[model samples]
Target: MKKLTKFKRIVTRIIVLTLVLSCAGGVMPSTFTPNAAELYSDKEKYISYNEETEMYEYSFYDAYVYDIDATPGQIMLDIIPSTGSNYYNYYYHKKILITWHSYNGENAAQYDYENQKLAESIQPESRINIKFAAKNKYDDLSYKDGYLGWESHKDFYVSQIISIRNSDEHIYGDINDDGIIDSFDVVTYQKYITDNLQYKLDETQFLNADIDLDTEITNEDCRQVIDFTLGSSKGFNGATNIGSIRIDNTVSQAMSLGVKNDIDFATAEIKFGVDVLKKCYDPEKNNTENILISPLSISSALAMTANGADGDTYEEMEKTLGNGLTLEQINEYMAYFISHLPDKDKEKVYLADSVWFKNDPTLKIYYEFLEKNRKFYNAEIYKSQFDETIIKDVNNWVNKNTKGKIPRLIDSFNIRSNTAMMLLNTLYFESEWQEPYIDTIDGTFTDLNGQKHLIKEMHSEEYQYFDLGNADAFKKPYLNGDYSFVGILPHEDVTFNEYVANLDGKELADGLREYADPETIRLCVMIPKFKYNYQKSLKDILTKIGMEKAFDPDNADFSNINDLSVEGALPLYIDDVLHKTKIEVTEKGTKASAATAVIMGMGAAPPEEKKTIVINLDRPFIYMIVDKNNVPLFIGAATQLSEN
Candidate 1:
């Protein structure tokens, strides 16, 4: 008996070793054996591998054990069939048995010894034994004290158990689970369909190779897959296999309130604004009429609009506004420029932006576009019902932001039924002059048409940044030194149109910064107390630039903006851009506000050498409100004045 016990222990160790090594080598693992006596039958069973059938045949045994009525403990027999072996690593299918037994013996050591012996005989069937203790007297076993002392009670029984195994299946479309379906999959699928090579596939592979998702793979599916490989079509359907790009939205920060110290990278945007401003100048408009535009405001709203554009639509918009800078560069510079626009004490300049879209279920706008606008432009987003109420909502937003200066932006019924979204920017500025002047005295102001009108001009003599040459210019600072008002009086030799025609944004901004150095001498400054409003549709002007494709509904591509898969979806394109501005220059200060709406379907140096300069605005002259970075907040030609 002692020798048999030692042999059982050695055999159990060998089975454990085999299981551990087999699991690591992609082979069937061995099972454990229990040691309790009378738990398993000693009748020997044998299993042999059939090479011809690639299956394991096992010796059958009596399906039933004794149906002995026990006080508590009960034992039974069970067998199950196996069926999984795809191409990848897996376990072989076979029958397995589990036994539940309890010993009611005073010698616990003897119980273990007898079970170990019973375990050795059942090795051929791959049996595993697990022994556990009952938590309470009413649990698995019941105890009773024998005359010899305390003894374990056998009250355990086997219950119904389901054997489930890991699934062996291939990934759909990506047959090899490589995350992409390329030429390799196409070739394999073609070979399988042609039957040139005997290829076997499970249900998963069948679903994967069915390109059209029609439950079967036909020759047309093969041709479509080939086209997808060649990039002629996106995928089996109208979708692309690649996932959409994602934008991170976890970042948060307080908006800055001062101008950017450096304006080096801002040249591209500033230059573009200047170029657009020059192009907006019309030679045929009334000579007495004034033209005011906030290029920065317009560009900002459009920059936000560009977030949803893709392909040619994006490229043209970028090229029109970049002036050589990439989209990333433009976004960085504009975000910095707008967020840090010198809104210090007594300088009430507000640059606000908003985006409004219809809350339609069919239009699935990309979160990335929305996130980009929010992060870069501090854009306020709203989803409305594209009804008549949207007009009031938009106008209310504009009016509230502009402090009522802009009463209404969207007309009573200008919003078309198909309008998907609208992007808006508003700039409000009200600053007291650094050197307050009395009311303008009655003076003679000549218009560009050579017509002279009696005007009330404000007068002051203070140390100012002044330059005199081909064109006389001066910079008068407002409340804070962070902002200044620039006046450019075209020389009598050239018209205001001719002068601006030769100017570009970089040179204009550079000149504003370079020529604004304070002079030792104080020069007499006289400027008219004027108030005027300019409003116009910028569709033709924007088209004149290289952005004509954005207005072409047939050619524009705003796939990145909203989902194009909806039935009856109209192409997103820009209908028009409406801009309105009002400026009031008085003895106390200058109050100006401008709103620019980039309505989309879905869319310098100079310097120097001047000490004391004298300039009289007795004729037509150009002016601009510039920030510390020389950004033109408002650029206009003051041609007429009110007598009151």
Candidate 2:
């Protein structure tokens, strides 16, 4: 009897030990938990290699980013991987860093967003490699374009930096990433203290030096402007002219076909610059010997780089749309659209890599869709000269794209001579806020004159909110992927302009996502749905809103262009800028469309928007178009919106 009892006790002990070793190991000792550093000691253990993008992806939260301000147009991320997302021994990847490039309104590269001149000139590097599958392979709301049957596995990441080139022989100068011209960048400026530096800056370095992002080289007067760099942040900070600008102006120009007969201008052309990029700086790298750079990449810091612009991967765009596209379609279209083109031509064309057509080969059909709906758009149809009926088809597409806001586009398109080779000029958009705002109450708010008015305000809840502590207000951004509507409400005491002027020193910060971050505010929110059309000379507004250097003709240098002769170096200029937009909402979603036509010298136009509330737009409120860096491209306040 004693021996049998002892045997039972031994069996129970064995079973307990087995349970402790299992995955759901219940109640392990506290000492077993690893410290942050200990767990991170072998960073590679946390991540896995993405066969598709050829990049090592880190699965851990807040992975290592060696320098947010690396080369001129890049941010070096020191990714140390760990088990995350799918780590039951297998690795699960999450987010990654990206770059975006800024647009050269007139000259390609000359100064920073604050209009500060670049101390030196460096050429931009080409080859923006971004993959969407890496960002949203597991999410449900991604979108794709074209006939490639929307890619199902295009997890995309952002590439948000832009780098351009310099035409002159000046050295590149930019030492810090504060976006300010400060003394810390003395070495950068010192290199260019004289134009005759022995070693000619590689095309890559010169590309990153062009801030203001115009292609002009610097002279002592512009480059060495005595006080310019005193405290300026010279690196790009990821801001472009509303990546939607080209699209906005395209439809506007076509609809308001009223020509500017009063001001006789010599040239009006907008160039497409996908392949025309040069290397951006990696301040953190600072390897003058073999300066490493990736050009045509989205600018991680340049204020002019847009999310939709180059630099970022089409994969990222697809991932944002959630589930409309597939990976094969995206790859096929990218291969086909960019199939045969010169470096210059490639630099001038860009397409949504993720969006695939039903019949992959008939891409021009998009233009035809617009052409058929011309009257509503009031746009002209430009016929294509490429495939058999590209001209007529493109014209119809212009109309369809605009959804009646623009009419008569592509009226004189030549697929080969006009549409195919020309810079794109058209736009189409339709999106509603995920969380709609309805004006259910008449709330009192103050305007500029210290006058209080009983205004009907729109109210709703958002996935996130940004605290405008500087403006004494709260900002709620409603996003439908790329298309979005942001409504800001200032504290009743402050005026719109007063709020804006004070915002100069403050950072323009916003954080929106499915999950809240530390900086996010979980506030009960209210948003007003107010629609108003704004008309301004695109060029004039660019200058008024802080990007003054680009319009400086003599200081502009854009010789990287194949057509633009480099007799020595050529000064640059912008000929025309146009914009048009429309917004509508219904039970389904918001339908917003816009176009921007920027004619660089005498080039082509490119075109590429949200939704509603129950509130009437009667009282005044502030509105602005700003870059990611907080540089306001355009700012205004609407006093009233006639319901008529």
Candidate achieving the largest lDDT: 1
The C-alpha stretches of model 1 lying farther than 4 A from their native spots are 1-261, 341-345, 462-469, 516-522, 602-612
lDDT tens digits, residues 1-644, model 1? 99996776466445434433554454432222222122323221122334543323333211111122221223222221211110111121122222233324344344345434443333212212222222122211211110111222322332211111112222345433234555555554555555542445544456566644334566555566555545566644332221211222332433333234356545655676666666767666745577788877888888788887788878998888777766666677767776665566447888888777777777777777777777777777777776777776777677777766675677845687667888899999988787665224678888767788887677676554545445767778897677878788877788777777777667665555554445555466678877777887888888888888778877777777776677645557887899988887866578888898877554200005655556777777888887766667888877766553
CA lDDT scores, all candidates in order: 0.60, 0.30
The parts of candidate 2 lying over 4 Å away from their true place are: 1-398, 408-427, 435-457, 472-485, 504-506, 510-522, 543-556, 562-572, 585-589, 602-619, 623-637, 642-644
Model 2 compared with the native: what TM-score? 0.31
TM-score of each prediction: 0.57, 0.31
**Candidate 2: 10-residue stretch with minimal lDDT:** 263-272
Residue 405, candidate 1: how far off, in angstroms?
A: 0.3
Candidate 2, residue 378: lDDT: 31
In angstroms, the error of model 1 at 413 is: 4.3
